[model samples]
Target: MVCRVSGILLAVASAAAVGGCGGEGGPTSPPPPGPPPPPPGPTIGASLNLRPGEVHVLSERDAIRAFEIQGAAEGREYQVIVMSASLSEGRTTPLRVRARADDVSPNVVPNARTNRSGRDAAIPPARGLAGELRPDRDWHLRQMIETERELRRLRARPAEGIGRASRGLAAAVSDVPRVGDTLTVRSAIVPGGGVQCTANTPIKSTVRTVGEHFIIVEDDRLAGRFTEEDYADLDRELDEFIAPVSHEYFGEPDDLDGNQRVIAFFTGEVNRLSEPESGSVVIGFHWIGNLFERENCPASNEAEIVWLIGPDPDAEFGIEIGVDFVKRVARSLVAHEYQHLLNASQRLGGQRGQDTWGNADLWINEGLSHVAEEVTGFYRQGLRVRGNYGYTELIAGDPDLVAFRDFFEGNLENAREYLSATTEFNPLALNNNTLDFATRGWGYVFVRWFGDRYGPAGPGGIVAGSGEAALYRELAVGGPGYLFGYENFLRAAEVVAGETTTWGDVLAEHFAASAADDAHEALPDGAQFSTWNWPRLWEELRTAGVRGLTGGDPLRRRIIQMGAGVSSTDEFDLGSSTARYYHLRAAGGHPSMIVETTIASGGNVPNSAEARIIVVRTR
Candidate 1:
C-alpha cells in the first residue's frame, strides 16, 4: 500500500509498505517523483538588431551569418571593417574575410594612447613596463612568485626536507601551537634591497589569541605591548569575517603543521623592513614557504603563516600598523593577505592554473585580494559612499566617511587609474609578474563587474554568500564547470550572461562599462555595472583632490572631446584581453548609420595588432 492512500486498517497497513520504498512486496512505490521536467528551451529562430556600433556575436562556428546593412538616409556614413580575430593561443589559417581597403585609410584619424595624449593626460607605463608590478608597492607578491619558482626548481633533488624538531632539524614544524606558547620562526629580510623570503632572519612569536580559524601570534617582546583585546580584535575580524570571506570565495587554507588554522604572525619586524624616506609600507603577507613541506623546503615552517607589521606609533621602524584595527589601516590588510593565503592554498591543493608557481593566474589572484579588501570594507563597516556627493561636502565632514575613505581607498583609486588608461593594460596577461595598479585594478573591476551580474550582488558591488554559495565556491575551486584561469572566466561568465559570451564580447562590453560615460550607453545592453554609478563617484573624488593618496593622483580628467558624425576612423593594436573604443555618429541631420562587420585574413587577432573599431555613438 502506498503511504499516499487514505487511512487504511492497521493490519493491512502493517503488511504493506509504510513510506518511501518499504521492504517486502508492496504496491510498487512510484519512483521518487523524478526531477521536475527540464524547463522548456527557448524557441528557435533568434534575431538580434544591432545599431550603428552595436555588436552581436555569431553563435555558430564556421557557419555563415547574415546582416542587412540598412541606411535610412543617403548621407548616413559609418565605417564597418571586420577583421578575423582570435583570443585563442595559436595562429589562424588564411581564412576568407572581406573588408574595405587592405591598407590604412587616408580619412583615418591617427589615435594616440590616452596616456600619450598630454601631461595632464595620464601617461601609460612604457611598453617595456607592460606587465611589471608597481615599484616597491608589492614586495609580498614579488617575493612569493620567485620563492615558488626557486622551491620548485630546487625540488629535483632527492629527500629534501628541512627536517623535524624531534630530530633536532633546522626550522622544523612543531606540534599544534597553543595560546601563550612562544615559537621561533625562520623568516627573511624585508625585500627592500636584500634577498626576499630567504628564511635566514629569525623572529620569536608568542601565541596570543588562538581562535577557531586563526592563531594570532605576536612578536615576543614589543608586540605584546598591544592590549590582549587589540590582539583578539585581529583574531575576531579574521574569525568572524576575513577568513570566512576568503574561504568562501577562494577556498580554504592548508594545515601543514596540524594546526588546522592560519598563524597570523603580527610583528614590528615587518614594518621596520621599510627603508627610510622611501615611503613604502609593507602590510600583512602570507609567506609562500609555509605551504611547502619543511622537509622539502628548508625555510618552510610547513604551516600556514601570514606576517603583518604590528602597531608602532613612533614610526621607529617605518610605517605604523595602528592599534585600533576596526577603525583603521590594519583591518584592510587582514582581508588582503588572507585572500592570498586561500587562493594559493586552493591552487596548491590540486586546482593549479597556467602560472609557473602552480597557482591561480596573478591577475585573477591579485584582483581577488583587492576585491577582498573592499568587500571586507563593506562587511566590516558597510560602504560609506552610498551616493554621489559634492567633492567639497564629502571631504569637509563625515568622520565615518573619512575613516572609510582611508580604509577603502586603494582599490577604488587604482581602478580609477585603470579607467584613465584602459587601452594599454591587458587584464589577462600572465607572462610575467607585472602586477601593477592597472592590471590589479582590471582584475578587481572584472570580479566586481561579474559579481554584480552573476552573484548575489548587494549594495556597492558587494557579493555576499548569504544568498547563494555556489558562485563563490565555483570561483574558488576550479571545476569541470569552470576549469581555471582565462578559460574559467569565460565559461563562468557564460553561466550567468548566457553561453554566447566570448572574449571579444567581454572585451567590447567591459571597455564600454568601464569607460565611465555614455560610451556604455551606446553599446548593446547590460554593459555597465548593475550597481554603482562610477562616473559620478570618480567625478566627485576628482573634484576633491584632497582624497588622493600621497604618491598617486585622485583621477585624470577625460581628455577626448567628441562631436557629431565628422566621418573619422583610427587604427588599433588589439592584443589578447585588451580593447579600444571608437565613436561613430550620423551626420548632423541624418537619421542613423549602419555598420556591417566581418573578418578577412589568415588573421591571428590575438597579437595581430589589427585594426578593429567598436563605435560608441553619442545620443
Candidate 2:
C-alpha cells in the first residue's frame, strides 16, 4: 500500500504502521553487511547539495532542530553525515543525535520494517590479556610531552657550552672517540613533572659502533648484553635506513658530540622510568634540553641525543629487553623519536628569536613524527606502492602483517582509540597543561589526512613528499607564530590552498570526512581524503581489535547504526574542539530522512554554545 506521511510517500504493507517523523517510521530490518562493502540501495527523493561549513543554529525557543536529507532526484546514490561539535573554547555540553522518517511511508525496505541510524557506534566486548596496561604509563607519556612543550614554550637557546666549545669539542670530523672507546657523558637527572635539573646525571659509556650519521653508545654499567654482530646491525639500520629517511623528510639534525653524528644513547635509566612489571612502558626518549647551552642546564650534554631503554637480559627491571626486542622494536624507536630530534633542530637551529620552535604545537609535531613512522615503512616496502599498504594480506585474512604494520601499527591502534575515546577529549582542542594517548592518536590521523590532501603527489599513489615534501616540511619549519591545533594548519594551509580558506570550512569537512570517508565527492572543495583505503584496512582490524583501547570493533568509530526504525543515543556531552558524528539512511522504501540534533530534554541550547552543524552526503 502507498501511504503519505507529512507530504512524503512511503510504500507500506499496512496503513496501521504509519507514523510521523517523531515515531518509529516502520518495523525492523536485518543489520546491514557493514562498511568495506556498502551495498547500493533504492533512489529516494530530491538531490540536495549544501555549501561547506553550512551552519544551522538552534534557537532558545526551538523544541528540536531538524534537517531534511533526500536521495538523488535521478540515479546517483548518497548517504548523510551530521556532525555536532561544541564551539566553546573550553567546555563540554550535552548533545543528542537521532533520525526517523516523516514525509514518506513506513514500509521502506520491502521485507524489512524499520529505519536505521545507519552505522556502528559500538565496539566488541573485552578480551583479557596476560599483562594489564598501567595508568602510570600514560602519566609518564604526558610528562615527557609536557617537558618538551615547556622547553619550546620557554624559547630555550643552545647551551653556553655548545656555543663556546673549543674547536675540537665542536668539530664534526675528528674521530678522537672512535668505536670501542669510552667517555663519561653528562646525562639528565631524570625526574617527574617536567622538571629541569642542573646537575646529577652522568654515566660511563662505551661506543659499540659508528655509522655515517649516529654513534651507538651503551652504558658501561648496563645489564643488557649484546654481540659485536648485533651492534653492527643496529649501526647499519640507524645509519643507512633510519637516518636517511629521517633526514630526507624532516630536514637535518645538529651535529653534536663533536663527531658529525648524533648519539643513540641506550641506557638502563630509561628502563628504570618504565613500569616495573608489564603495562604501558616508556622504552625510549629524546630530551629537547640537549640542544641548549650548558648555562641552560649546567649538566646539559649539549649533544643531539635520543635515549632508549637499554637491554636487560634478566627480568631485573620488571621488563626484559632481549636480542629480539632490539631486532624488532628498538630499531623502530629510531624511526619514531628521530623526527623529534630533527624537528627541534630545523626549527630552532639558526634561531628565529622566540616566535618559532618554542611553541611546540603538540598535534602537528606528534602527527608528523607518527607520519615519519609510516612513511619510512612505505619507503622500505618500495618507494610508494599505493595499495601495497596492508590491503591484500588484510583482505586475505593473513594473520601476520609483519612488514608495514610494524611501522604503522601504533597509528592504527591509537586512531581506533581516538574514535572510541571519551567524548570530553577532542584531538585538536587539547589543553597545554595535559595530554593523552588517544589525543596523540588523532594527531597521527590528522597528519595522515593532511598528507593525503595537501602533500605533494607521488609515484605509485599520493605519497608523503615523493619529490619535494611541501606542507609536511613547512609544518616542521613552522611559521613565525606556531600555536597548537588548527592555527598551525591554518598557516601551513595557505602554502597550498591559497588565502581564503577558513577554519569553519576545514572543521566541517574534517567532521564530514570523519563520517563519510568513502564518497570523497558529494562534499565541497576541501572535503576529501585521497590516500588511504579505510574500509579494507578497517575490515582487517575486525579481529585483533584493541583490548583496552577499543573493547569492541575499532571500525565502529562514531557510526551509529539505527536499523529500519527510529534511533537515538543517550545524551552525550560534547567537549570543546571535539566532534560528535551521527549517520542516517532510509530503508528500501525510498523515503526522505529527518535528522534531529538537539538538547535531549531542555528549553533551548545555551548562547555560549557556539555550535555548528555540518552535514555532508556520503553515497
Clash count for candidate 2 is: 30
Per-candidate count of clashing residue pairs (backbone under 3 Å)? 12, 30
Task: Indicate the worst ten consecutive residues by lDDT in candidate 1.
Answer: 126-135
Root-mean-square deviation (CA) per prediction: 21.9, 11.4
**Among these predicted structures, which one has the highest lDDT?**
2
Cα lDDT, all candidates: 0.50, 0.56
**Could you give candidate 1's per-residue lDDT for residues 179-222 as a string of tens digits?**
77777876655455433434556777788877888887778756
Q: Candidate 2, residues 1-619: lDDT per residue as tens digits?
A: 1121232444534233443444565555544543452332222222234332332222212213445454333322233433334444557666555555444342232222212222233543222111232223254345556655655555455543334553222343354457867766676645532335354376888888878888888888772477788789888877767777777677788764556788888887676665564455566767777776555455566678887777777856556756555456666677778888888776656463444554345666777887777777766655452342334443243255444345755666667656655454555455644465566577787777766665544542223334335666667777555444566677777775455465655656665556555554445434545445565456545544533433333433334342334444445666655665555443343445555555645324454555566555454
TM-score of each: 0.68, 0.76
Query: What lDDT would candidate 2 get against the real structure?
Result: 0.56
- State the displacement of the C-alpha of residue 112, model 1, in Å, after optimal TM-score superposition: 7.0
